[model samples]
Target: MVTRGTEILVIKRNDPAWPGLTFPGGHVEAHESFHDSVVRELKEETGLTIKKPKLVGVKQFYDDDDHRYLVFFYTAHDFSGKLKASNEGQLFWMTKDELQKQKLAYNFDRDLPVYFNDNLSEHILDGKRDELF
Candidate 1:
């Protein structure tokens, strides 16, 4: 999920998944709302508490190596708790333009820009239907 406040928070996964400069999120747990997953992921990965995470967009990524991922994006305006280094990676806030320049795990190159401009409704209704990456 994409947790956006004034700045974007990204993490480098310590595991095999794309491990550099990625949106802080993960799998949707059993019986959990997508929104709650966003909150839970943020808190677990970054130690932050968030309120009202807005759904942003959904997108998929497919790699030549046969790795694929589907992600639900979300944004939070209100948050508390201190930022500490977790197993995920270093957390940092950056402007949208700055994000474009980072070595973002592949899919972000195509999807995140769309999210920055589009409203939540457009994203929910039509975003995931296409392959942004």
Candidate 2:
């Protein structure tokens, strides 16, 4: 996940799952550290070249489609580039307060507040999605 100021960056996904409001990240490449993957995925999805982001947490999801994902969450204090939308979907800069006002994609309400409160690291690292609520 990438955040600008108090606002978090969320991608409106084009796929079947949720199809909107996802963190800016994806699968880690071979031989890549989780941190490096976060940077790479951010650039690929958001078109922003971020400085070294601090590791916050990891989220693993399991769905009926045999879907499994381990998402590495990070926070960046600085970055350099223009914002461009990726094939994933549109990008929105949502402040913590503004989040409740918009039509957020599913599950975002479960996840984003953790990121906003900076408690994402502990929950994710512990594989505690169920505890989020």
- Per-residue lDDT of 125 in model 1: 21
lDDT of 1: 0.69
The 10 consecutive residues of candidate 1 with the worst lDDT sum are 119-128
Least accurate 10 contiguous residues by lDDT in model 2: 119-128
Candidate 2 local Cα displacement, residue 118, angstroms: 4.0
For model 1, what is the alpha-carbon lDDT of residue 101? 83
Q: What lDDT score goes with residue 50 in model 2?
A: 87
**Model 1 regions more than 4 Å off:** 1-6, 61-70, 119-133
The residue-by-residue lDDT of candidate 1 on 1-133, one tens digit each, is: 3345556777766766665677777789999988888888888898888888887666655556657666776778788888766887787878776777888874556666556766432221233354332
